[model samples]
Target: MPANKLAVVTGASTGIGLELARCCAEDGFDLVIAANEPAIEAAAAELRKIGGSVVAVQADLATTEGVDKLYAAVGDRPIDALLANAGVGLGNAFLGQDFGRVRRVVDTNITGTLYLIHRVGNEMLRRNSGRILITGSVAGFTPGSFQAVYNGTKAFLDSFSFALREELRDSGVTVTCLMPGATETEFFRRADMMDTKVGTDKKDDPHEVAKAGFDAMLRGDSDIVTGVKNKLQTTVANVTPNEVLAKQHRKMAEPGTAKP
Candidate 1:
């Protein structure tokens, strides 16, 4: 509610992360934004024009060094919100995929995000105030064939957010998970999935998904699925057998599956 509460958004270089940073700035939050790309400087400058303090940290989020860079940017600021939205999407047939790339995905999406959450959440707990919004994906609920690594990383994030939310109940620190379905983002292009059905298809807007998470975090909801279609898919996946869900997912995510 303050005019200059501090908000830190990771993966703030592009896509959903960029939108989150913009939303926070509009809502009057001084921002500590981190991203791997050199372009984040432009994004930070744009936000600064909106009348909020802005600090941009450029670091590769797939390693400890990058996470440390992000923390160092925040320094001792008492953050009011933390948006752990940095992530990567990698799609490749399991057997033929590059193992190193798979590790990078896991490192960035799961390990790096969690490390930031741990540091920020502790500070939030100590201050007895803060909100955390994590970006998860609908892909987490099903077994993705070609996008296996990305999906698994999201599964960890979604599950971790739920558990963390419960643990932080009554602590004045809120944790919210934003599980978005297919969304138009640079993610697929970066992941080399531009030719896939899930990649090239019409998708939800990243701004919409960011707004959903922003609003939900303010409301202190534990988790939210952004789209109606994604809500239904989440419900069905919850009740369906894993095998059947995996088969369905494979149709959309596998590199060699035949479409009807």
Candidate 2:
């Protein structure tokens, strides 16, 4: 990548997204970081301490307008890296989830993500350079009993990233997918998953997961599954039947499972 090149990272207020932004700043990339919450400003401040110019944009990436606003912040600068990590999750039986919340998950995780990629990827193709890292999930490999929408969206992303990478193989631009398992983040509280086993269980450190992903993106790897346990989970998921996987998911994600 060029010196002082620009990189845009979504969902950058916390967790893996925030760490990914930190990695970019440390690597001396000028950054445009965005998230739906006000904390994005604080994140930008922290990133500035890392010595790179940072711009924070508060945007709901679940909508086209929000995605447009985010890109507008980039102005005419060429983005050297794009971390399409903005996402939302909903936990509960699919039928019991609120329609609005469900729609938000779908829009943020699938529609908005794809829209951003389409706009940015085209620019990268024109320049014949740039790297993209998409945050997918191990959950996508299984049928999530209580996280139906979230997992479904990740499945789409995982599949979409692979296909996009293949199509761009000779284009000089690279696309990589980062598939992480459950991690210590605000995601559980935001998703109202605190009552589930997976939410309460010990999770991977967000920093480690982000490092794994950022490195993979820099290397132009096709995909990376963070954490040894998560790697094992994905390996087993490949051969497991959907029905059995769904049952296994229920044991961890069903409401009240977190109760001692």
Models 1 onward score TM values of 0.95, 0.98
Q: Return the lDDT, model 1, position 73.
A: 83
Query: In each prediction, how many residue pairs overlap at the backbone (N, C-alpha, C within less than 3 A)?
Result: 0, 0
lDDT per residue as tens, model 1, 89-166? 888786788889888899999889888888888989998999999999888898887887788889988999999999
The true-versus-predicted C-alpha distance at residue 73 of model 2, in Å, is 0.4
lDDT of 1: 0.88
Alpha-carbon deviation at 226 in model 1, angstroms: 0.6
Q: What would you estimate as the lDDT of candidate 2?
A: 0.95
Flag regions of model 1 displaced more than 4 Å: 1-3, 256-260
**lDDT of candidate 2 over 167-224, digit per residue (tens):** 9989989999999999999999999999999999999999899989999999999999
lDDT of 1 at 21: 93
**Alpha-carbon error at 180 in model 1, in Å?**
0.4
